[model samples]
Target: MAARFRMKRKGVGEMLRMPGMEAEMLRRAEVIKGVAIGLSPVDENGPHPGHYKASWETSSTRRGGRKRDRAVGYVRNTAYYARWVEYGTEKVHAHHVLLRAAQIGGRNQ
Candidate 1:
């Protein structure tokens, strides 16, 4: 004879409704939101990327003959985030999973 154990599955919304789960979810949500919004443009140098140049110019002519010229240059650097992994026998919460997902998604983009 073989022994079998039954497993239960809970929906994300259902898990979050639990007493303490809600707070955890909220806290994690805030962390994710902050990370996403705070790190809009990440670069050590400036807005443009390296190995490239940008410029702007303007000219005008009138009865008096007026002329104007303008130029601009910049380099861009791509943003990146550190990779994280969790390992242990400690219990894992739903909110933690959600927060991790948020962090991963934000970093990837």
Candidate 2:
């Protein structure tokens, strides 16, 4: 996303007006790096007990309306956002490499 500025002429009097100078001040903003971890039905189960089965199962209760289940699922997705890492972090970088390797291995299989 970017923005552009332009001067428009309104009348003959406006034409006689001097053009105002436009200056753009650019700054180095914070760079954010992120990785999306998508889980398939075929990912390997780690040594952590109950991690694999728990990851695939629905945590929402069957009680109440369908909207409740939908809301729960949305909340679950938002919870995954905490797992995303900003740039310049070692943990995130390592996770990225592991995810890539897993994807490639899956493809080969």
Candidate 3:
């Protein structure tokens, strides 16, 4: 059997070749990263804040055919129990800080 359509793979430069588009994408990623970095909730009930403070990260690059999809910004906790805090173990309850952070970051972008 043969396929009815053919599509060529695109490279990063070909996708982000527009004027200043790469810079703009990086800037947007930075904006989202900043928001995420500051978004971890501070609460005595949650895990220690140090891990949450150090884990925010961002990445930007040329990919796909659209400028809006090239940036990636995310936050993470390095604590041993970060998952427990986010998802909760049987004895713990989910704090949902990451989920909230993403929501706020999306709104800010």
Candidate 4:
């Protein structure tokens, strides 16, 4: 057949793809993590007693369940007081390192 189907779209199939997109994304993730950690307030005991720095961690893993092929960088903080530090507790001051880092550092990515 000369025309198998109706074509109402352009060439999305030939769109340019960045070869280092995956790697760049991962690198950006790590950069954001570093900025967060750096911005976190440090204490005599350790980094961010508020849990901002204490629990902050970075890891590499897959994005989904075989849905994608590129590995990604993951950063997180699991400290119990982490939230208290970020949002602030009744007596503590609100230290917005996580938010600030993502905003500022993410720009570098």
The digit string of per-residue lDDT tens for model 4 on 39-75 reads 8876768654555565677665444225444455666
Runs with alpha carbons beyond 4 Å of true place in candidate 2: 1-46, 49-53, 57-89, 94-109
Q: How far does residue 61 in candidate 3 sit from its true spot (Å)? A: 3.5
TM-score (C-alpha) between model 2 and the true structure:
0.18
Ranking by lDDT: 4, 3, 1, 2
User: In candidate 2, which residue pairs get closer than 3 Å at backbone N, Cα or C atoms, i.e. clash?
Assistant: none
Off by over 4 Å in 1: 1-16, 42-101, 105-109
C-alpha TM-scores of all predictions: 0.27, 0.18, 0.51, 0.58
TM-score top scorer: 4
* Local error of candidate 2 at residue 50 (angstroms): 7.5
Q: What is the lDDT, from 0 to 100, of the residue 24 in candidate 1?
A: 46
Which of 1 and 4 is the better model by TM-score?
4
- Give the alpha carbon lDDT tens digit for every residue of 1-109 in model 1: 8999765554533443454554444454445544433333323485543211111112222111122121111112122311111121345312232244466644644
* True-vs-predicted CA distance for residue 97, candidate 4, Å: 0.9
Alpha-carbon RMSD, candidate 3: 7.9
Task: Report residue 42 deviation for candidate 4 (angstroms).
Answer: 2.0
Superposition error at 54 for model 1 (Å): 28
